[model samples]
Target: MTASPRTPSAAPKTDTTDATDTTEPAAGTGRKPPRRRKRAALLTMAAVVVAAGTSLAVTRPWNTDHDAVQSGPRDTTTKVERTSLSSGMKISGRLSYDAPTDVIAQGQGMITWLPAPGDTINAGGKLYETDGESVVMFTGGRPLWRELAAGVSNGPDVKQLERNLVVLGYAKGLGLTVDEKFTAATATAVKRWQKATGLTQTGRVPLGRVVMLPQRTVRVQEVPGKLGSAAAVNTVVKVSGTALVAIVQPGEDQLSQFGPGRQVTIRLNGGAEIPGKVRSMTPGSGGNGGDEGIQDKPTVTITLADQDAARTAGQSSVTVTLIGTTVDDALVVPVTALLALDGGGYGVEVVTDGTTRLVRVELGLIANAKVQVTGDIREGDTVVIPE
Candidate 1:
């Protein structure tokens, strides 16, 4: 009990030591730096997340689902014939016929000129009568006996007979040009021509004799007069030929569309449709309705493809057509199936085995709802139209 208390005998010396309570505000020099740093980091992370979300909303980057909104295999077409041929390929081509000869002039004083130069009789055209109208030239139709004697001394009958020789495919023996002068050369060519033509004359061009020429002239004029009345030694009458042609004009826009070697068909003014080809044309097509404010119309010449004596006899006028290029055995399809891709190209959706896949395709030579395509895709594959 109190035994331990006896040790405190001397009153503790009260040493007065000034002691300040060192209770400082937890070393205030050290600030709460870490807590603020952690808060700042948290805030920065949140801001970053927001920015990322906004960027995603604006950009709306690539997405498979969004890629969605998008998108006559009639080959074996023939140009000319609808029915398939056994072997020959069909082509659109024009038909050209030979131009006919014409003879002109009748009851002439002196046969001034002739159309064709050859002496092939009845070559088909008009003939000018050798009535020696002009002293320099002479030519004409076959002369009858009654007029023969009268023409020999009165007109250029002999000269006319000689020139007729030249037109009959006979060579001018005396080198006489068709200037209409009576010459021995004319006699030789005429006689040869007469012999070839089965005429009764000897191998000599005689006065009052008329010979025929092959081929005719497009135009002619007949002179009225009595036989042997021509001023020149001998003169005769009877020239034969006619004039007929049709001119057709195409639209100005159709100029390029028309070309050489193009097939054409026409329905004559009063006849059936006749096939033909482009014979010739004016430099260019005119304006609207084919009128360039000019008196004459710009026209194209068309030669009949086929000839019919009866058909041509009727009053004739015609229409013309110009052909265009075409292809055969071309693999084609409905133009609608061609879908434009987003990347400035073309594509097609192919359906194979119940699955559809889009494939890029290259197109070539598009015409009339049909287009040529080349790619890994083969023909006969079903195509899915893009919705």
Candidate 2:
């Protein structure tokens, strides 16, 4: 009995498996054991990884500390700057006179003489000759509608004539008062003017003897009348001011961007640039009958600051740049440095002492590839641009 008890047989073989076992079955056995616990553990690990990634993206842990240094190449970074930013658009334009007026020939006569193009006629100067008689220029706001005689009614036309006579030294010693009246003094001054200019010493100015213009001086641009042709009431010549201006026809949407006194730039054909300012804007007829449905545009007039510089270009095509919205003393950075944030905003990578951090910013005028930025940044702070 002692010998039998000495070697207690090993415990009977049992077909039980450990509850926490995860070992795969033997190869080629084709046995697919339940693996729910394994799958659940793997899913839990995946959820943790996803949560960490989300936190990293939203929180931007690298930029959490302001004092941290960022390492980046010096050439890939730019400094925040303070400067003036403006939005502008360039359009084709013509460099020519500011205001062009047609000189119409009144009464009937033979056009014996005509001023050549580019001829500058001043106040009281001869404009043309009809029937071998000089047609003089008069500086007045209104045209001479009737013959200037002693019995004519008092009006601004008489006052304009008196003023011209006074300016031209014809009213000297005549005690002429520049009022809206054709008195004896005015008639006497007219006679003096006529005698000095080789005209008949008539105390009245004939209707066809004078042409009124607003400007004191004008440059003749064209002569529609030919010598020896019979002159009927028609446009005899075209004239404009001596000063040059740039004319641009912009879209209707651009009307608000231009106005009187707004500064602009005029680029000449030779690549020279000059400063200018808007002088006036005229509502255009938009598309004409022959335009085939072209859009309507407004005509903008710009005056050059330097008339001498513009005269060098003469009547030629030019480039006009209109400055629209502008911001002064703006903190700016390269547009390429902006980063799209996760929660719908923009940010920039600010680098300081070899460390970089994300900085939230508010955007403003974007011009010439430079963006206006305002945030927790200084003018000299370095911002990294993605390579």
| Candidate 1 per-residue C-alpha lDDT over 34-151 given as tens digits, one digit per residue, 9 for 90 to 100 | 1100011112322332322211111111111111111212212221112111111112222222234222223335454333323232432223334331211233454323333222
TM-score of each: 0.37, 0.70
Give the Cα RMSD of candidate 2: 19.6
Residue pairs with clashing backbones, model 2: 69-354, 69-355, 70-354, 70-355, 70-356, 71-354, 286-296
Q: Which candidate should be chosen as best, given TM-score against the real structure?
A: 2
lDDT of 2 by residue, 1-387 (tens): 000001112233233221222345558865433211101121232233232221111121112112222353444788999999776777889998867999988867999899999999998889999888899998988888889899999899899899999999999998999999999999999999999888999999988799999999999999998988877688888999999999998765567667799888899977789999998898977566466787557788998988878888889999988655778999988766766543234567787666665565656666666667776788999887663
